[model samples]
Target: MKEGIYYDCINDFLNKNRDIETKKLLLVAEYTNFELKKLESYSGEIIGAVVPFIVYNNEFFNKGIISCDLEEENNFLLIENLKEFSIEDSFFKKSKSLVVLVDGLSSYISDFLDNLFQNIPENTQVIGGGAGKMTFERDPVIFTKNQFCKDSAIIISLNKKLNLGIQNGWEYLEGPFLTTNSEKNILKTLNFKNAFEVYKQVVEKDSGKKFTDDNFFDIAKSYPLGIIKYDKEVIVRDPIFVDSDNNMVLVGDIPQNSTINILKGKEDNLIKSSGIATKKAMEQIDLNNENYCVVVFDCISRAIFLGDRFVEELEEMKKNINPSKNLFGALTLGEIANNGDEYITFYNKTCVTGILC
Candidate 1:
C-alpha cells in the first residue's frame, strides 16, 4: 500500500513523484488540480478523476490531490462513451466487487447502471459515486493516466468483496405519489399534475415558507423526494430546480410509475444516519480480514445544506469504524451504491460506506 497524502500543487506532486510509474496510481483531485499536460512525462497505469472534493482521514478538502495505489490493473475498465456504455463479457469474469465512478451530469448514467448490473455476475456488489462539481458544469471529469474523459465512467474490479451500507435518514412526510411523466433525470409530473405545484403544496405547508423562483432550492433542499423499493430501504433523490413547465429536475432519474413520497430531514437524524451506515459496513467485515479500508460516497448537497454542521456527519462516522481503517471518500454530486441483495442504482442525498479488505 503506497502512502495516500494530499498535495496542494499539481506541479509539486508531479515533480516529486515522477518515479510513481512502477505502481498503479489512483489519483483523486479537486477540479482546480486537474491538468493533463504531457501525459508522456509520467508512466504506468493511472486512475484519475476530478471531483468536487475528497475526504481522507475524515477531513474534507475542496482543493488538492489525493493519491494512493490500487490493487489490480487488467480488471480496471474506463467507459468513455457513457451513452453507449458497453463492456466485454470477459471483463467481470474474475471480479468479486466493483468500485464505480461516473460523470454526474451524464444523461445515460441510469441506463448504464441498469445495464451493468443486469449483465454482471451475480453476488458481485458495487460502490463508488458520481464525479462533478456543485455548479453542475460538465467537462472531462473522469480520467486515466493517458486519457481524460467526460460523459464517462471508470470502474475498478476487485478480487476481495466489500462490505457495504447505504442510508439516507429522511423521514417520509407525504403520500405515495406516482411519477406520471419522466425521462432520464427529469420528473415531469407527479400524481398527474405539475411536479412543482404538487411539491410546493406539500413543502410550503410543512416548512411555512413560500417557494419563489430564486429560493426554490434553498427551500427544497430540506425536503427531498424518496422512492420506496419493495422490502429494502427507501432511496432518496434531490430536486435541484423547477423548470418553466413546473417539472421537477432532479439529480438522478426517477422512473415513471414509481411510487414516491416527500421526505423531510433534520440535523440530528442526518448525522446519526452516518454512524448507522458506518456500523452496518463494519458489521459485515470478514473475520479473516479484521482490518479493512473505509470508502464513502457522500452527497455534496448534504454538505451544502448542512453547512458548518457537516462536520458532525464525518464526526459520527469516525466514532463507529475502527481508528485503524484508512478512510477514503469524496463529496459527490450524486451517490452510487447498492446495499447487499438489492438493485444497483444511482442515488442522491445519501451516505454510502464500504469496508474493503
Candidate 2:
C-alpha cells in the first residue's frame, strides 16, 4: 500500500554521482522456492517506488539493466548449474562497483551464495535481511500471483556505493556442540538419537523446558542455530523442520563441520541490534550531517517471539533514521552479508543486512 523505504538509497545513488547512469544496474532477490513469486512481486513494488525517483533524479543512465532470478530450489538445484548463475554474477561486473539488495529465504541461501568474492568487485556492497513467513505454505501479500502459496524469491542489483551492513543480536548459548552424523544440510545425529532428542538433552542440561512435539513451536521460537563465520562471529540460522530418521535435523543450512551453538533473541536485543547496525553503518561515512537510505531484512521468528515487543524494534528505525528515505523489506529465513572486503557472507536466522548509499 505504501512505498517501501529502500527507495531512499536507490534515489540517492541516482543523485550523488553524475556518472552512475553510464554503468549497468541489475536487481536480484535470492529467495527460497517457497517465496520466489512473492519476492518477485515485491521487486515490482520496489521498481515502482524506485523508477519515479530514478526518473526524477538520475535518468541519464539511459540503459538500465534489470533481471530477477528466483534462486534455485534447495533439493532440486544442480550445484554445477547453480554455480553458472551465481549470486556474485547477479551484481559484480568488470571494474564495476555494485549496489546490491538481498532477501534470503531458508538456509538454502548459503548453497546459492557460496564463494561470493570470486565474482563480485572490491567496491561492491549490499544491504538486506533474513525475512520470515506468515505461514509455511502461505505467501505474503507482496506476491499475489501464486495463490499466496509459499515457494518463491526475489533479488535486485544496482551499480553504486552504498554503505551496507546486517545486524543480528543472537547471543551464543552453551554447547558449541558437535554433530556425530549427518546428511547434506540435515543433521542426522548429534552424538546420537533423534535430532529433537539431542536438543532435549541440551535443554535438560542447560536452561529451558524439555521439547516435545506438542511444544516444538516453543523451542523453535526461542532456540535457533548459530553458524560460525570467518571473523569468529557466530551467525544465527533458524531451524525450520526436523527429520526423525537418522536423527537428522533439517535446518535451512548445515551448521557445518564446526561445533553448533544455541542462540537466543529478545525484544530489546533485536531493537538494540538494529540501532547498533545502523549506527555502525553511519560511522562508516560522514555521520555528522550525511543523509542515508536504509533497508532491512528481519527474521520472521522475531515477529513471532516479540508479538507485542515487535513494535519497539520497527519504531526505533523510524525514530533513528531519516524518515524521508524510502525503505522496504520482507521477513526471510536467512540473510546474506559480506565481510566488507570481498565475498558474500551467507548467514542463517540473522536480522537486517543492508546498504546505505
Best by lDDT: 1
Each candidate's lDDT (Cα)? 0.80, 0.46
Clashes of each: 0, 45
Which residue runs does candidate 2 get wrong by more than 4 Å? Answer: 1-91, 94-108, 129-132, 138-155, 192-194, 204-208, 246-251, 287-291
Q: Write the per-residue lDDT of candidate 1 for residues 1-357, one digit (tens) a residue.
A: 233566665776678778766544344546555567644566666776778888876678887776766654436788989888678878889877888988887888888888888767888889988888767667778887678889899887877778888888889899889999998889988889988889999999999999886998889889999988777568788998877777888888888999999999988899899889999988887657764677888998887778899988998898887776666778887888875556787989999998876
lDDT of 2 by residue, 103-202 (tens): 2333344554555456556665644333233344222312322232122233344443466656778776666677666554576655554566767676
Model 1's C-alpha root-mean-square deviation from the true structure amounts to: 2.1
lDDT of 1 at 151: 89
Candidate 2 local Cα displacement, residue 49, angstroms: 15
lDDT of 1 at 285: 74
How far residue 259's Cα lies from its native spot in candidate 1, in Å, is 1.0
What is candidate 1's local distance difference test score?
0.80
Best by TM-score: 1
The runs of at least 3 residues in candidate 1 whose Cα sits more than 4 Å from the true structure, single-residue gaps closed, are 1-4, 22-31, 38-40, 287-291
